[model samples]
Target: MQRKSWKKPALIVAVLVAVAMVTSFCRSRETAPAHGNGAPAAVPIRVAAAHRGDLDLTLKVIGRAEAYSTVNVQARVSGQLQELLFKPGGHVKQGDTIIRIDPSLLQAQLDQALGNLAKDEAQLVNAQAVLKRYSLLIGKGYVSQSDYDTYKANEGLYLASVKADKAAVELARTELSYAQIQAPFDGIAGAPLVYPGAQVTANDTSIVVLNQIHPIHITFSIPETGLAGTQASMARGTVPVTATLPGTKLPPMQAELDFINNAVDITTSTIQLKARYDNHDDHLTPGQFVEVVLPTTRLTNVVTVPVVALQNSPLGSFVFVVNADDTVQQRMVSAGPSSNGQIVIEKGLSGDERVVTDGQLLLVDGARVRIVTGNG
Candidate 1:
């Protein structure tokens, strides 16, 4: 009876062990990755075709708007400020009078100069007539030799005096012209520094300020490393430039790269650049900060992909390249500047492969993918 009871306990223990093992096995299978047991499931991904085309390698930097020209209307001749011809902050065209000095004194000086010139002319004519008469009398022995010599000397002296008087007249006229101050270019004029009835000296006092607003210039700097590329682009053709004014609804201003500084800034390690724009609408102003965009160069027949296709990894930035069998391979690519949602692939692309644009999170190396028409 004891042996039979021991055998029954043993059979019960065996059955319980078998049930535990089966339960553990089922749990293990449930927890295992789906790809581990069989072929990986296809991950739905959006893709873009890499193409060979032109890529504009562009750069953006902060720039400042500058007037094409700035002028300080200073007195060129000393005088009393007689009239302020232009209102404060008035728009002026080239040669438009902005200020007028008291010309009464200058006019009187001119008149005096004219009178002196006339007097010299009359004296010169009298000296010539006397010299002629002396020459005739000397030939006929009617006048003393000393008297004839005196008249010749007087004629020569008067001739020089007339030339001097003519020069004085021109000088007086030039001094008179300085009485009126005109705008040097099309610009906006600031208030007169020397008001009417105030005394100002030649080039010693500022009468007004003028700034050219239309056809303005934008100044910016880029790193020295980009100098070579910028110069090469300029040599090839007109480098395209654009400026965006902040806090304004105006469209971006388009311009051409006009000036590149000959020397780089040693302290900043940057090279300065200037662009010319036609600001006929007066949308841009002097000293205003703006954002500048420039296309430095174009790469022809280069492989390019959408910017979204670029993926960052622990190693580096890469993109998933789709093979013929719909298997995705991670391609480490060197990227250049991006423009309009497209990025230049400098390396590791042949311009014919498909690149994954979305659903990259579900992908791994050599993962099979299903290309979806829409972004996934």
Candidate 2:
């Protein structure tokens, strides 16, 4: 009876020990990391997203600025520069005297011409009297017809001399007027090439340069492919253009299209164009290169995302889309032109979807993602 009772107690202890071992094994299996499963925990990355909306397509190109009118002032007559009527680099109006040449020689010539004209006038008066007398003598037949003819011929010779002298007088007057140089238009003058007492010749090197700045012209070139679109836009109405000065943060100046080249450049395949701006403040200068911005028609109902969200691989461009279940989906997308650091998503994305922008390289398809809202 003692042996049987000991065996039953030992068996009960063994059964309790087996139950404790099984319980420990099940806890360990449940607590260990799961592996080789289809779904895995995802690494979190910062991201940004936005809904699609209407956007504008803009074309950008570098352009240069030019003056509306440029003039190189030159002398019209050969003479010594007697006086400077305008200060160098000063503004002048049309018909304003810019330089004066000595008129003494011209004046002397004019005086001589006048004296000769006076002598001719006296001779012409005497000729008229003689002709009148010959006419009277011929009517009375007081002398031979040949004698009267000789008097008439003498009168005609003196009259012709008077006309020649008159022409000389007019010639002298023109030379006198040429002594003064005048501005042809309203503009700012450049430095004078010839100072007072310097000799100047007609059609010689330019004495100064004058530029009209009130209405300035901006010239730029665009690829020939842009011509059709530019023409269409211009046909519809005036196209707006903005020009920004170099190395300055100031706002761009406004301008309008003035001209478009009819022919395209075969070498560069570019179309030259010009814009006019009201530069009454003289802010823009000639020959200065400027940045040009031309706004095109806006696109409607388009999808655009930050440029950083895009990834390139052998499979092409893609984006990581976050789902409602806190899972990521890798989707192939088509991209359009980028502007302002934002790229247009042409396909594979809807307005209601969220895309990863800041960080996306660590994403994998169907991976559980931790939602860290308001952390960006």
Give the candidate number with the greatest lDDT: 1
State the weakest 10-residue window (summed lDDT) of model 2.
Answer: 33-42
Model 2: colliding residue pairs: none
Candidate 1: list runs displaced more than 4 Å: 1-47, 297-300, 313-340, 356-376
lDDT of 1 by residue, 291-342 (tens): 9998876778888899999999889889999989989999998988788699
- Model 1: lDDT of residue 34: 62
Model 2 quality (TM-score): 0.66
Question: Tens-digit lDDT track for model 2 on 1-376?
Answer: 8768799889999999999999999997777655348334456665677558876566777888787899887777777889878877778898998878889988999999999989988987987887788788788878789987887887888888889988999998888898888888888888887788888887885678888877889999988877777787788788988888879877889999879998999999998999999987777888888888775555678899888888887999988888887778888999987766778889989867787765565667876666566764
Q: What is the number of residue pairs that collide in model 1?
A: 0
The local distance difference test score of each candidate is 0.89, 0.81
What are the TM-scores, per candidate, against the unseen true structure? 0.80, 0.66
**How well does model 2 score by local distance difference test?**
0.81
Error of 1 at 175 (Å): 0.9
lDDT of candidate 1 at residue 150, scale 0 to 100:
92
